[model samples]
Target: MTAPFIPVNTPLLDGNEADYLAECIRTGWISSEGPFIERFEQAMAATAGRRHGIAVTNGSVALDIAVHALGLDEGSEVIIPTFTIISCAAALVRAGLVPVGVDCDAATWNMTAEGVEAAITPRTRAIMLVHIYGLPVDLDPILALARKHDLKVIEDAAEMHGQTYRGAPCGGFGDVSTFSFYPNKHVTTGEGGMILTDDDALADRLQGYRNLCFQPQQRFVHEELGWNARMTNLQAALGVAQVERLPRTVEIKRRIGRLYDEHLAGLNRIRRPVARTGYADNIYWVYGVVLNDEVPFDAKEAMRRLGEKGIGTRPFFWCMHEQPVLRRMGLMRDESHPNAEYIARRGFYLPSGLALTDDEIARSAAALKEILA
Candidate 1:
């Protein structure tokens, strides 16, 4: 019999997930309103070291809420990493804000403060920073620049849950931060996300935006148009269960990362994820592998071969500046981010999900080496 295929990402749901779901069904509180929603929001706020957490349907929507809540001018520019998900840029664009893409560092695969500094303009309103894969963007210098320029920092900590930078929480730094509880994330809410903030007024606005801007003074009245991106009680129930087991989950991810490091140490054809940086250790959100020039093929070919061996893989995010949509819209028309462009073509991640086993990890690494050889 053929062996099973190890998926690129799978969540570990061995917690109170079933119990929470049972409670939700028994109580008939499965909509956006329920005790679990508040509980999950509060728990996540505490986890992220923020005063308030606004639950939403997904991370992309959370970004949309965050960007609009800032109340930036229509054409204000926000700097973001070029090598990041389209959702990041889309949030700004849809909010009538301009997104300026910056190149990330080759080693950490995270944006540097210097690149952000150079991208700052008089019309720059905020630094919408994202923590890439597992490692965090160097935040201190960026925070300093934000302070100097009196700009807001919108932290996209979707990939940095249970992570910190220089002993501070990843989601706690910026004026506002967002987290995604996708099945692939450390905290899986079965399609949920949150916006975190210490500012009471901002939190209020965020809540309003996520829920159709309902006015508290009157029922079924809306002074402003907003998204109906509220998270269901069922999703929040899962989030509450997952947040309770986060520390254990983080440790599991770290162990998997270390094992991959040991097993693939001598594979010169592929570059491993950065183990640690000056301020923090990589949480290995995904054990990304970059094919060097000697590999003789791009990530697509490598992933195809790995798939044939029943080892799943995923490619890195494409550079936003090179996106056809952005160029077609006449935004960043002729820009290039060299480092991100190079990795976007060659980098891909292995099976690093919480459901992965030791044997699977070893087999995946062995398959990769065999293909390279």
Candidate 2:
């Protein structure tokens, strides 16, 4: 038996991270509104080709701010991929709007432009495009559709830090975008998030939402009822260090992804992920393999078997509209997202973090072959 453990995720921090955190503490501005925060926001904005980037507590809050900044009123609808983190749908719901879950494209596993068109109603106000598992969702068609329909486009780029779609960065393409800087993300700040936008007004509104809607002009003036969702200078310091190192991290991820593609091919039960043509860029946060529906095994069984081999893996996201909490909102009824359902049942992610040693990857791959063969 292979010895006892492979973690599903691990933080990719070691060099200079502790020093940076210490420097932030020495500076005594660890809470908020400090030099590191400004620096991080600016650096991220530049990376995304956006004029503004607002730091927030987490990706969920970033999504909430993005939704609120759009000015969508009650009963307004937001179209989102059903196969995504529940936070994407929950953000829209929290903003007093309706979430219309749409099916994903069979080939790319992202929102299909045709599906978006079919789901849009007169009440539709926006479309939130999620770049799942680091792959760029096909965006040109979706952007064109948004323009034609005059709908706002919000990008959930939490899984795609350096990914590009047709030469444009993932977070740079939408009207507004949100990013998660969780410990496992390509570049992390412990527990932080960012909002990137070309719209100055939206940026300002999001910043306001991050700080309890406190007026910039008056110290304690409240402009709107908002949550205290703020990222600290310590987190920003960590972010600055991580962002500076991201180019190398991205290259490492791509190299690993290609290796997985090459080595895992021809395995009977596994269907490798394919990067769509005309969309070459990706971050490879999680490398996925779809289990064949006819294989007589499901995700749960597959994961359990892998676990017994000391191999760690996780199932894909359950379709958000099918979740119990969202069901009470009446958002999922009369809706069936076949692709999302299929992936949820047959998909699981491998250990693809940048820090995974090559030997570990080979060992894991060997274990997968043993089980599948």
Candidate 3:
């Protein structure tokens, strides 16, 4: 009999999650606003060491609001990594701004200060940093560069809930940070996102935008044009439950990731994920291993072999510079970023869900060893 497939990503749910849903039903305030939503936002803000969090419908909307909250004029350019989800670039475009795609650091698979410095022009308005794969991107250098250029920093902390660098929290490092509570994230709220910041003025602007640009004191009075991107009370109920269990869930993910690290660290054909000197915390959303170029087969074939063993695996995001949408929009070109392209082709993720059992991990490891051998 064939072994059951090990999925690349999965959500771990529990009775606590159900309890939140039941409470929401009992309260009968399942739509736009409720006590659970307020409580969830409060809990999340406390977790991130922030003063406030504005819940949104999804991550893309969170990014969109972050872009607009900065109050940039049309045609201002926002610098973003070429290896990020397309939403990062599209959000800037939606705000009537230009996106300047920068190359990634091969080590972290995230935007480098060098790339940002090289890409900046007089029109540059902000630096949007993405903490890819739950690994905190080195923020000091990026922040310094932003200071020198007088640009703002908006962090996409979607994949990095509770991740830390040198004892500092991920969301607190950026001027304003956004998070996603998609099912596949470290925590789940079915589908939701949040914007957090210590800046009360910025937080207030974001909250206003989230609720159809109406003043909190006056109902049905519009001051600025905004979209309806509010998170439901039902989703917030789930979020509150997940937030309570997040510390344990993150611990499990880290333990499983360390197991992968211990097993794969010494392999000649595999390049394990590297942590810089000061980054102390990571949840390892997906255990990424780069296949050394000297390896006999490329990433695609490696994935195929893993799949044949009943292991579900997939390739990483293709570099945004090479994506057809950005190219068609007349933004990127061939000579833009070779590092992003190389990492895109070489990196692939393995099964790294929090729910994977020790037996399943051992089985997956044995399959990988056999294939790589």
Candidate 4:
């Protein structure tokens, strides 16, 4: 008989998640305003090496809040990876800032400093450095460029919870950084996110944005418009537990990557994700592989075949320039991001969730090799 299907990802909630959640329920502190909420925020900020952490309902809303907190004028340009999730661009657009798209590094699949430099213009007000997948972007040059250009750096470290650059943490470098506690991430809060920053004023603004911009002196009086994106105490309970287990989660991801490397070593029709020499080891956020030109099929076709064998996979993000929503808005009208387009068409990730077992990894790798062969 065939084995049960392995999923693309699954949340690991075996830690203190249940205990903390039960405490929240027993204490009747399940709402947005509760002890767990503050504890989670502080713990998350400390983990990311930031002074403050403002919890929000989800990753997309976290991005929106971070962008608005910058207070950039309408039409100010923010450089972003063309290969990132739509949340990056959408946040900037919603805040009345123009998003300048740049392609990723062919090897790392993360945005290059060269691309950021090439995309910069006088209207450029900031850089949204999205650390794609499990690896942190090459940030030294980007930080130097921002310093030279007086540009604000917003690090979207959603995919890089426990990942680092050099000796520093991913979220620690940005002027204001953000993280998602989505189920697939290293740490999960079910459906939650947090904005991290060292600046006192920016942290204040972030809190205001997440809480409907309530005036401190006058309760229910609003000084400016904001969203009700506050994360509940129940989510915070989960987050606190998840954050405590981040080190182990990262180890599991690396182990899965190594297993894939071992199992898929002889497959010549595909190229595996890169782990740069100087930076942190590629934690393999997902065990993605890119089909070489020698392969007769595209990623979609390869994925279909794998699915037939009961293996789950996910396609890479489509380039922002090719997105129909952005196209309709007249953005990236004539721009072509070759690398981003290539990766989007050719790359797909295997099951690399924290909960994945050795047996699942071996089975998934064998399935991929068979499908490609």
List TM-score per model, in order: 0.99, 0.96, 0.94, 0.99
Candidate 2, lDDT over the whole model: 0.85
Candidate 2 clashes: the total is 0
Residue 102 CA error for candidate 4 (Å)? 0.8
Give the poorly placed runs of model 2, Cα more than 4 Å off.
1-4
Please list the C-alpha lDDT of all candidates, in the order they appear: 0.93, 0.85, 0.84, 0.90
Scored by lDDT, model 3 comes in at: 0.84
Q: Taking the tens digit of each residue's C-alpha lDDT, what string does model 4 give over 264-301? A: 88888898988554777897888888999999889999
Best by lDDT: 1
lDDT of 1: 0.93
Local distance difference test, candidate 4:
0.90
Better of 1 and 3 by TM-score: 1
Model 4 TM: 0.99
Arranged by TM-score with the best first, the candidates are 1, 4, 2, 3
Model 4 misplaced regions, further than 4 Å: none
- Model 3 misplaced stretches (Cα beyond 4 Å): 216-218
Q: What is the lDDT of residue 196 in candidate 4?
A: 95
Error of 2 at 355 (Å): 1.1
lDDT of 2 by residue, 247-342 (tens): 888888888778877678768677777755567655678888788866777888888888888888988999987898888867777789999999
Candidate 1 per-residue C-alpha lDDT over 1-373 given as tens digits, one digit per residue, 9 for 90 to 100: 9999999988999999999999999999999998999999999999988999999999999999899989999999999999999999999999999989999999889999999999999999999999999999988899999999999999999998899898888889889999998889999998989999999999988889898998889958888889999999999999999999999999999999999999999988878899998999999999998999888999999999999999999999999999999988889766788999989999999998999999999999999999999
